[model samples]
Target chain A: MKIAHHAHKDIVIPNSTRHLVTVRQAVFDVIQESGFPEHEMLRIALAIDEALSNIMEHAFETENLKAELTINLSLDADEEKFEALILDSGKEFDPGEIESPDILTHVASGQKTGLGIFLMRQVMNEVKYTFVSGFRNELRMIKYAHDFKTKGATNAGTQDHYQNH
Target chain B: MPELKITTKIIDHDITLIRLVGFLDAHTFEELDVVINDLFEKNIHKIVADLSALEYISSAGAGVFIGALAAAQENSGNIILAAANENIHEVFDLLGLTQIFTMTDSVETAAKAFECNA
Candidate 1:
């Protein structure tokens, strides 16, 4: 089970909102090079941005340690998959414990929290979180290249791929 | 500085039309929040967000609307979405905002909703 990739890039930046554009541009460049459609490319970038925001909001809370966040972008040629891996040196948190926002109820009540995780789970084909040793966390977001192809598969009816832990 | 431009147009003293161009994410969303808050302060409750040129929006951008819409509803107004691209629509749909928002094909039609209600 080997999936060959065509393009790959690794980026590291400080844990700050200002660096979101840097990460988004890198993911956009890689996704563009992978020949993914422009619209889907933007969506992927948005998902990656949300993940980065989550790291800044929760993981880096309580203290602004001089830390760095790593983002890895890769496209599998054989499987036509695009994946982004975000690693952070922030507090350990459980992604499974986050519930999907009752969007309707929440919207009716004016709550903005919880939509970041929901967007990550909804936009990307797959999203996973892992807690590495000692205050390290990795969030993975994946999208199928074919899903954005002009004549490729429609995203409708695709099974949810977000996993716990 | 985020690469986003927001232009606001006040119509009829009750409706505020905002045009969003470029991307909306955590960094750039504050610009939107500021404009919406200013509108609320002025007692302008109804809003129409023109997203025809909006290239991207993260969840935080969408969250801005959640708060704006709720406030509008409380003030007997509404936030109408107009000309959203498929990508923007997908995010809105994923969050089930379609049911919560009144989406129209054009700003003309969205503006008419306010007229009809009035």
Candidate 2:
């Protein structure tokens, strides 16, 4: 009998929304290869899209900042879990501090944006953020296959790690 | 490149059916925002977005509808989403938007929703 090894992929692209579609397709391919259920594959892809969108819109706001910056993405998946590590050299952002909006109040108030982070948190089992002053920002998101089967499992089983070094 | 194709049809003089094809993400959400805003400028608030051909949607895409919903309602009109595939529906469900937005099985049903509201 032979054992299959984990699959890993790394991609680097300019910090621009133009490449989001390509990135998404690549993410989906990896998830599908990892044997994730069809429903969970789309959810995972959405989480990555939201994270990258935030980095582009907030972290690299200025044209000058975007001109020189690049986003480094890594995907690692095995039979047990799928993990994504996104690295960018832009401004630091902590999604944890932003309060989750009450959906009814949010829409009634005529707000359109601010829902990306909420969606990311909802789909992924782990969302960890780390920043090194004047260096880089790292966001690691993970989803366990088992977690999807047991939906609404408490956050006690996952880690929401945020660190500043 | 990110692509989103949007086409509009006038239904019964009041409602407009906008068909969306391709991916709706951060890169292409503004195109939708512009189209919907254009409709509002023409006093065409009753809208039915036919999403059967839509391949994908992110929060940015969903935001376009959220921003326009209040304006439509205040003008005695509404935006109903119809024929969203299962994956698209999941995005709405994750955002808690399934509760706020009216969704139907097809464009015809969506247009009827506007009639019922009237």
Candidate 3:
């Protein structure tokens, strides 16, 4: 079974951070529709949020910002898998080169930026970055429930979720 | 974007405590560097970061920590993480930083780790 959904909204102040819940819910709905648990859906949602945050920040300049963020969500019922594509007409960026901060070191003192992309690489089964015409940026991420490569204790189908600790 | 909010505390004469909250992803990751650099001028060599309120982080954000660690180390200072959730620990474990840096379950323990070890 294949579940597909697409959401397009203009760049508005509310959409920046506040709308993360809405965007995440739309994807979670797809996970539920696909017969997956909440934990699986959240992993997908958080990944989407990270991708969209990058697009909104990198694609649109802070001064003349108002770009559209398009998210395509697809799930394979037979495979028990989820995939999302984040498309933005923002500036060009490649997260691959960004090195992950040494958490041990940061734990002792300060924080860093490139850690976001690194964490995505670890949790998601596949993450790809591409640019079309140096104007549009695309981030495609995919994960399979059966793979069980990346996980948190509160994954889909699990009852306990540490919403806050 | 991970929001890297910085708060400070006085730990002994040389150590400074930094509290991080919200998501510290790609968007606000760089700010961590700027904040720490400014703190360097204040002679904060030993640092303890409270990630209790932090919800999310990515590799790029991880890079910030590494850079700050190097910077602080050069000045004979150190960075320690305190009270990280399982998800955050997973990140550190994957990167093999668990062995290199000190991690504790709580802020108090984290501070003691740095004061005793680093």
lDDT of each: 0.75, 0.88, 0.62
Report the C-alpha lDDT of model 2 over B2-112, residue by residue, as the tens digit: 399999999868999999999999999999999999999999999999999999999999999999999999999998999999999989998999999999999999988
Query: Which candidate, 2 or 3, would have the higher DockQ against the true structure?
Result: 2
For residue A74, give model 3's deviation from the true position in Å: 7.4
**Per-residue lDDT of candidate 3, residues A1-165 (tens digit):** 555433232223232544555565677666766655456654566667666666655556755445344433333332356666666666677776566655555545545443445546655676767777655666667677766554542333211111111
lDDT of 1 by residue, B50-115 (tens): 999998788888889888887898899989999999888888887788988999988889999998
- Tell me which of candidates 2 and 3 scores higher on TM-score: 2
Model 1 interface RMSD, one decimal: 1.2
The lDDT leader among the candidates is: 2
TM-score of chain B of each: 0.95, 0.97, 0.87
In the range A1-165, model 1's lDDT, one tens digit per residue, is 333336677776676777788787887777666555555766677778888888787776556453454334333312377777777767876565677767778987888667887777667766667786685676766777565552332465222333324
Residue B10 alpha-carbon offset, candidate 3, angstroms? 1.0
Regions more than 4 Å wrong, model 3: A1-35, A40-43, A57-79, A90-118, A127-138, A148-165, B1-5
Off by over 4 Å in 1: A1-5, A35-39, A62-79, A146-165
TM-scores for all predictions: 0.84, 0.94, 0.65
Q: Best-fitting candidate, measured by TM-score?
A: 2
CA deviation > 4 Å runs, candidate 2: A1-4, A148-159
